[model samples]
Target: MIRRPDSLKTFLQAGALAGLCALALLQAPKQAIAGPSGVAGTALFQQFPLLYQGVLVEGMGGAFTAVADDSNAPFYNPAGLDNIQSSSFQILNISADISYPSLYPTLYNGVSGAGNNNQNYINAFSSVAGQSLYARVGDYSNYTTHDFAIGLLSNNQMLGVANASPTTTNLGSLAALSDSGVVISGAYGFFNHHLQVGGTLMGLYQMFENIPSLSKTQASALSSTLSDNLSYGFGLVGNLGAIYHFDLPLNPTLGASILNVGTANFGNAGSLPQLINAGVGIDPDIGFGRLLADIDYVDVTNYLYYTGDSLWLHTRFGVQYQFPEILTVSAGLYEGYPTFGVGIDLWAVEVNASYYTEEASPVPGLNPDHIVSLQVAFGWM
Candidate 1:
C-alpha cells in the first residue's frame, strides 16, 4: 500500500527527470559556472543527442564528404585527408533497435545517420487502445548506446531503465549504466586527392541511480539507491572538411564537411554547448551498388539557447545498396515525419535487419516506428 500521494507522484517524475539534467548543466558551452533549477534543472540527466554520427558521411543518405576516404577523412574532413598518398586505419560499428510509443520497443543505441520510414509508420499504428499492449512501456522505459572507437574514438552513451514492473525493480547490470563518455580525435592529411583536417577532444563520465521502491514485496517499504553530482568538462572540438572528384562520365564523387563548432565542459555543472554541422556527398558511376546522400544543419535552437523551446530542427535522408553485388539495401526519413530503416551488407559488414510502417492506428506510435542496425568495418589503404 504505497501511499502519500504515490510518493509524491514519484518525486514528480524524478523531479521532472532532474530538471532535464539540470538544464544540461546550465546550457553548457564551456566558459563555466552553471546548473541550477532544482536537481540542476533535470532533463533526465542530459547529454542526449549524438550516438556516434561522427561522420561516415552520415551513413548513406546523409551522404559522404565526396564519397569519403583515407578512411572517413579524419572524422569527415581532415581536409579530406589532404590527398593521403597512403596510410590508413578503420573500424566502425553501429547497433540499434529504436521504437518509441511507436513500434513499442525502445532501445536507442548509437545512430549512424539516414532515417525516416513514414514517421515510423505512423508511430507504429497509433499505439493501439482497444485491448492495449502494442509498444506498451513504463518501468524506466528504454535507451541504450555504446561506441568503442579505436585510435580515433572510444564511445559511451546511456539513457535509462533495464528493469521496471508492477512495483518497479532493476537490481543492476543490464550493463550497469547511467551515463558514460569519451572522444579524442586528431587528423591531418594534405594534397594529391585527399584534403583533410581534424580536431576533437571531449570527455564525460556520469552515474545517476536513484532507486526508490515501496512495493513489489515491500523489502523495506522504500528501497534505496541515490547518486548524482559527478559531472565533467573539457571541450574544443573542430572539423572542417573537403572532398571533390570528377573523373567524368559518372566517376562522380563530391564531399563537404563542418562539425562541432566548439564548447564542452561537464565539470561544475555546465557546458555541452557549441555544435554546427554541414554536409553533402555524391558517389555516382552507377552499377550494382554504392549510392549516397546527406544534409544537416543544427543550431540547437534559439539560434543558441537563452532558455530554449521546442526545437529539434531536423532534416535527414538515407539510402544504401550493395545489391546482388552482395546484398545490402536501405531507406530513410526522420523527425515526426518518421519513415525509417532496413539493412544488411556483408563485404565490410553492416546490419540493420528491418523497419517500415505508416501507422493505421492498430498500435505502435499510432503508426510510425521500426528501426534496426548493426555495423562493423575495417579497411586500411
Candidate 2:
C-alpha cells in the first residue's frame, strides 16, 4: 500500500502542481496543441520523445546519425543503407515504462478517498496517471546491391495508462500519439561507394483518444468509453539523407539527414515539425574488440517546446564496443541525461536493454523521469 500525504499543506501543494500543469498546457507551443496532457496541464509530449530506431541506437543514447549501418539506417539516416552488403529483414520493439514516485502517491490519495469535495482532485490524478505507458514497434526490410539499395519500413508509437483492478479502481485512459508511418526508402552510392544519397517517402497517420471526464461513477462504467474514443488523421512526409565515408584512420564517417520535410496536418492537431540531424562517427579496431564513437546534433526547426531551455540544438554522444558478434556495451549522454545499454547477439536473434532519463515536464523545478527499455530483434540475412 502506498502512503498518502497527511497534511493539508501537502494536499494544497499537489493541487498547485496540477494547476501549474494546466497553465503550462495553455501556454504550450503550437506543436503541443494536439498532444496528450493531464487535466491540470501536465503535457505528455515528453512521453514520446524524438523517435530513435532500435535498441542499438537507444543503447548508444541515440547517437546513430553517422553510425547507421544496419536496417535502422532508414530511420536514422537512409544514406547508411548503402553500406548494407546483403538482403536483410529486421523488427524492433522499444518501450519506455515511466514511474512517477511522487506523483503516484498523490494520485492514490486522491482516488482512494472519494467524496464530492474531492472529485476535482480525483479527476486531476486520473488524467496525470493515465499517461504511464509508452511503447513503439517497427519493422525494416532492405535489399542491397553493389551500387543501390531499397527498403520498406513501418513504425508506430503509443502512449496510455490502464488500471483494471476490478476490486479497486477501474479508471483508464489512452492517448494514441502521432508519427506512425510507412516509409519507402532508397539509396544510391557513387564514386566507388565513397558517398551515398538517399530519400524516403512516408505515409503518415496520427491518432488520439481520451475519456472526457473521469469520476467514481464513470470509473465504474468505463467499459463504454474504452471502446469508443478513437480519432485519426492521415498525411504524407519526405526525408533526405547523405553520408560520406573517408578512408582515413579508423574509417571515419560523416552523415546528415533532413527529416519530416513535408507537412503532416492532423486536422486541428497542427503539423509535425521538421528536424535536421548531423553527426560524425569513428570505428576503430582494437584487437580484442571494435570501438565505436559518435557525436551528433539534432536541431528542430519552427518549434519551441519542451526542455525548459530555449536552445533548439540537442547534443548526443555515444560510445560502443563490440566483441565480434557475441556482445556489445554502450553508454552516452542524451540532452545531458545519462543513458546505458547492452546487447547480446546470437547469430539469428539479438537482445538489448537500456536505461535512460527524460524530462517529464519542461518546467524548471520538476524532477526528471526515467525509462527502461528491453528489445528483442529477429534478423534474416
Best by the lDDT measure: 2
List, residue by residue over 219-322, the lDDT tens digit for candidate 2. 54446754566556776766667776665678777777766553344654334555566788987657787788888876533233554353322667899888
TM-score of 1: 0.28
Which pairs of residues collide in candidate 2?
A: 21-40, 21-41, 22-40, 22-41
Error of 1 at 125 (Å): 22
Q: Candidate 1, residues 1-381: lDDT per residue as tens digits?
A: 112234455455445334433443343444234332311223222222332432223334333444444334444444444443444333444333333443124222111111333333223222231211111110111111111112434344322222222222321111112223444444453332323344444344433322222222221222332223233433344444444443345444344444444443444444344333344445554665666544433322222322234222334455555455445555544332333344444544544443432222222244333333333443321
**Model 2 stretches astray by more than 4 angstroms:** 1-52, 91-174, 178-181, 210-229, 266-270, 300-304, 308-313, 363-365, 379-381
